[model samples]
Target chain A: MEDALLQAFLFAQETAEEDEGSLIDVVPGLMVWTFVTFLIVFWVLRRFAFGRIQGLIDQRRDRIREALDEADKARSEARELRDRIAQERQQAKMEREQILEDSRRQAQRQLEQGRERADADLRERLEKNREELDAENARLREQIRRDVVELTLLASEKVTGKVLDEDDQRRLIEETIEEVDVKRLASEN
Target chain B: MSPLLAAAESDFDPQHEFLLEEWIPLHLGPLDLSVNKAVVYIWLGGIATILLGIWLMRFGLSLRPDRRQTTGEAVYDLVQSQIAESSIPTKALHIWFPYVASLFLFIWVLNIIGFVPLPISNDTFDLFGVELPTLGIYAATANLSVTLALALITFFATHVEGIRYNGPTRYFKSWIPEGAPKPLLGLIVPLEVISQFMRLISLSVRLFANMLAGHMLILVMLGLIFIFSAWWLVPFSIGFGTVIYLFEVGIVVTIQAFVFALLSGIYIGGAIEPEH
Candidate 1:
C-alpha cells in the first residue's frame, strides 16, 4: 500500500511539471468562475432567502413579547379583582356586626321603656284604689253613726215614756257618740 | 452488464478524472479561459445552491413553517449561531454573515455534487457499435485553483476588515505579539509575515487535499478491479469503494465546508479585534 501510494505520488510529481493541465495546476478560468459564481450565489440568497428568515424570527419574537405582556396584564387584573373581593367581604362582615349591635341596643331600650311604663301604671292603679276605699269608708261611717243616734233617741223615748225634742235628741246623740267610739265600731264591722 | 465489467472494459486511469478537458476553448490575450468540467461543475453547484436556498427559504415562508422551511431555518440558525456568531464579531456580522453562510452552502453543495456520478465526461467507449459518454465523479473544490480563489477571498476580507477597524499601521502590527523583546522583533516580524501567508496556503490546501484524497481513494479502489480484471476482485473493489464513498459523503463532505467557513470567520473576526 505504501509502495502504491509512493508510486502514485512519484508519478504525479513526474507528470505535474510536464502536464500544463495537471491536477494541481492553477487554472485562471476556473478561479474566475468560482469567484463569480460564489459572489452571485451570496448576493441572491442574502437578498431573498436569509433576509426573509430574519424577518420571520423578528416577527415571532414580537408576538411572544406581546403574548407575555397580555398574560401579565391578565394576571394583574385578576389580582386586583381578588383584592376587591376580599375587601368587600371584610366590609360586609363589619356592616353585619354593626346592624346586629344596633338591633341589640334598640331592643334593650324598648325593653327598659316597657318595664318603666308597666311599673307607673301599676302605681297609679294602687293610688286610685286607696283613694276610693278611703272615700267609701268615710261614707259608711257617717251612715252608721246616724242610725245609732236615731236608735238611741227611740230607746230613751220608750223607756222614759216621753217624746224628745230636737235639742234633746241632738244632746242625746252627742252623749251616745261620746260614750261609743264610732271609728272602733266601723273597724269591728 | 455489471458495473465492474464496464469499468474493467475501459482504460480507467484513476488520475484521469481530475484532468480538465476543455469542451469549448476560449482564449483572452494570453490566458486560456476555456469552459471546462471544473467550470461547469462550479456553475452546477452555484445554480443548485440557489435553487435549494429559494425552495427552502424564499418560497412558501410563513409564520407557520413547513418541513422545508424548518430545515432551512435550522441551517440558517446553525450558521448564524454556531459559525458567524461565534467566529465573526457582532458589529460586522450583518455584512459577513451572508458571505460566510453562502460560502458554506456553496462549498457543501459542490462537495456533495462531486460524489454524484454525472454524464459529463469526454471519456467514452464503444459498446455494440454505439458510443456512450462515461458518468464520472469530480469536484470543483478538488482543484487547487478553485480552493485558492476561495481562500484568497477570505484572506483579503480579513485584512480589509482589520484595516477598516484599525488603521493599516495598527492592523499590521497586530500580527506581532505585543510587548515582545526588541532582539526577537527581527525574527518575530518575518515569522508573523510568513504565518499570514501560511493562512492562505493552509486554508486552500486543507480543503483541496481532503476532497482530492477522498476522490483519489475511491478512484484507486475502482481502478483496482480494472487493473486485475478478475471476477474475485469485484467484491473487494465495490466494498472498499462503497465504504470510502459513504465516509466521504457522511463526514468529509460536510466537515470540509464547515471548517472552511469556520476558519474564514476566525480569520476575519481575529482581524477585526486583535485583542480578541
Candidate 2:
C-alpha cells in the first residue's frame, strides 16, 4: 500500500508547474476517471457479490416464515384436542351419574320385594301352626272320652260284682257315656 | 519553525491540496487522460471498494455469520433497505441496487481517504540520497470535477431509464404539469427544463461543497497557527483543528456520501415513475 502511494506521488517539486484554476473549476480528465472508476466498481460488485447475498437473505426469510406457520398450525391442533377431550369427559360424567341413579333405583325395588315376600311367608307359617294346634286339640278330646269310658266300666265291675261279656260291656259303655255327656265332660276336663 | 514547515508555508494554499498534479501525462488528441493525484485516488477508492465489498460480503458469509460476514450483511442491508429498496421500484431493483451501493461506498471511501494522511504527495523530500514522497492528506471527492462527473452519470441514467420505462413522449411530458393554463405553458416549460439541469448542479455541488468545506475548515484552523506563528496559538489551533478534523471524518464524510447516493436514487426513480 505504501509503495503504491509512493509511486502515485513520484513527480516534481512543491510548485504546480502551471497555475491551478479556482476551486470550482471543472477538469475533464478527473471527471472521466471518476465516471469510469465508479462504473468498474459497480459492475464488479453486482456480478460477484450482491446476487448471492440477496438470495441467501431471501432463503432465510422464507425459512422463518415456514417455521412460524408450522407453530401456528400446531397450536390450533392442540387447542382442538383439548376441546375434544373436555367434551368426552363431560359425556362420561353424565353417563356415570345415570348409572349410579339406575343402580340406586334397582336396589330400592329389590328391597321392597324382599320385605313383602318375608311378610307373606310369616303369615302362611302362622296359619299352618294354628290348624295343627286345632287338630291336636280334637285328637286329645277323643282320647279323653275313650279313657273316661274305660274308667266307668272298671268302677261298675268293682261295685256290683257283675262279669259282663264283650257285647254287653260295649252296650253298657255306650249308654253310660251317652248318660254322662262325654263331649261336655271332656270339654270341662 | 521546521524547514519542511517553512517550505510548506511558502507553497501554502488551502486549495492546492485539491489540485490535480499530472504525474503521467497521457493525451487523447485534445482530451487530457493524464494520471494525476485525483485520478490515482479515484482508482484507489474504486479498487479498495471492490476488494473490501468482496471480502466482507463474499468470503466468509455463512448461515451462522461471523463478525466479518455480519458487518458485510449489515452494510448490505443498509444500502438495500435504506437506499435501493426505498428509491428504486421493485422492477428496477435488480438493475440498480448494486449501482447505488457502489456509488455510496466509492464516494465514502474517497471522502475518508481525503482525511487520512498518506505518503502520496505532490511534493517530496530527499531521504538517503533518494527523493522520497512525504505524507499529505488529499481527498479525490473534494474536487468539483469528480462529483460533477458522478452527477452527470446519474443525470443521463435517469432520463434513459425514464424514456425506456415510459416512452420518451410520456416520460418528458410528465415533466409539464397537467391542465396548466396554455398561456403559462410557455413559462413553465423553460422553468421545468432548467430545473432538470439544476438537479445535476445540486447533486454535484452538494457533495463537492460539503467535502471541500470540511477539508478547508481543518486546513484553515491549522493554517491560523502557522499564519500567526505564535507558540500560544498552538493549543487553540491544534485543539480547534482536531475538533474540525474529527467532525469531518466522523459525520460530514459519511453524510455527504449518503446524500449523494440517495439523491441519485430518487432522481433515477422519479424518472422511471414520474411523481407529478
Candidate 3:
C-alpha cells in the first residue's frame, strides 16, 4: 500500500510536469488588466445602471402610497356625506309627517265645532215654529165661539118677538164643554 | 465479454508497460508573463466584482428599502461599522471609504471563484506549444500570484492613505504617541512601521494560502479514487470530497469574503487614524 501511494504521488507530480504552465507565468498581466477592467466596469455600472433604477422604484412606491392615502380620504368623505344626507332625509320626512298630522287634527276639530253650531241653529228654529202654531190655534178657537153666539140670538128673535130666553141660554152654556188650548199654547211658547 | 477476459484486458495489468516519464520545460528569463487560465479567471473575478459592486450601489440603495436593498445595505453597513469605524477613528474613516470598499469587493470576488469549475486542458503548444490553444481560466485566487498582486495594491493604498491623511511628517510622528517613553519611540516606531508593512504579507499570504490549500485539498481528495485501484477506497474518498466540497461552498466562501472585506477596512482605517 505504501509503495502504491508513493507511486501515485510520483505519477501526479509527473502529470503536473506534463501540464506546461505554472501559476507564476500568467499572474502579472492578469493583475494589470483586472485592475483596469474593474475601474471601467465600476464606473459604467455606477453611472448608467444602478443609480436610476433604485431611484425609479423609490419614486413609484412613494406615488403609490400617496394615491392610496388619497383614495382612503375620498372614500371616507363620501361615506360621511352619504350618512349626512341620510340623516337629513330622515329629518325632513319626520317633519313632513308631523305637519300632516297636525293639519288633520285641526281639520277634525273644526268639523266637530261646525256640526255642533249647525245642530244648535236647527233646534232653535224648530222650537220657534212650534210656538207660532200654538198661538194660531188659540185665535181660531175664539172666533168660532163668537159666530155660535150670533146664531143663537137670531133664532130667539124669530120665536118670540123679543130676546127673553135668558134662562134657556144659561142652561145650554152650562151643558157645553170648555175648549182647552194647551197644545196651541205649547206651540206658541 | 466474459469476466475473466475483461480482467485480462484491463489497462493496469502487470504486463502492460506505461511510461512514467513526463517533461515540462521551464525557462525563467526576464519573467515571461503570459495571460494563462489563472489570469483569465483573475480578470473574470475582477470584472464580476466591479459589476457586482456597481449593481450593489445602484440597485441596492433605496430611499425606502426592500429585501434586496436591505441585503445590500446590510453588507455595506456591516463592513463599514465593524471594520472601518471600529478600527479607524471616526474622523479618519470617511476618507478611506472608496479605497476600503473597493478592496473589500475585489478580495471577496477573487475568493468566491473557487466554486467555479474551471476546465484545465493540456495545451502546452497553445500557451507554450505555439500550436495549441491555451489552458482555460480557473480559480485565480488558487494561485499565489494573483493574491500577492492584490495584497501589494492594499499595501500601497494604505501608505497612500496614511500620507494623504496626515501629510508625511505628522504621519510618521503619529507612530510615537505623545507620552511614550523617549527611548521606546526609537524601538517601537520602527517595529510598528515594519509590522505595518508586514501586514501586506500576512494579508496576501492569508488569502493565497487559504485558497490554494482548499483547492489542493479538493483536488487531492477527488484524485484519490483514481490513485487507489481498490474499490473500497472509492466511496471513502468520494465521501470525503463531498463533505469538503459542501463546507467550501458555505464556510470557505463566506469566511474568505468576510476576511477580505474586514482586512481591507482595517488597512484603510489604520492608515487614517489620528495620533490618539
Highest lDDT scorer: 1
Cα deviation of A48, candidate 3, in Å: 5.5
Number of the top-ranking candidate, with TM-score as the measure: 1
DockQ of 2: 0.35
- Give the poorly placed runs of model 2, Cα more than 4 Å off: A1-18, A106-189, B1-8, B126-130
How much lDDT does each candidate structure score? Answer: 0.87, 0.81, 0.60
For each candidate, give its TM-score against the true structure: 0.83, 0.82, 0.54
Error of 2 at B180 (Å): 2.1
- Which whole-number lDDT from 0 to 100 does residue B120 have in model 2? 86
Off by over 4 Å in 1: A1-21, A99-189, B1-10, B125-131
iRMS of each prediction in angstroms?
2.5, 6.9, 7.9
* lDDT (tens digit, per residue) of candidate 3 on A31-98: 56555655665455445443455465558678889989999999999999999999999999999999
Ranking by DockQ: 1, 2, 3
User: What digit string (tens of lDDT, one per residue) describes model 1 on residues A39-142?
Assistant: 99999999988898889978978998999999999999999999999999999989999988998998888888888888888888888888887777787788
Q: Any residue pairs clashing in model 2, and if so which?
A: none
The DockQ values of the predictions, listed in order, are 0.49, 0.35, 0.12
DockQ of candidate 3? 0.12
The docking category that best describes candidate 3 is: incorrect
Winner by DockQ = 1
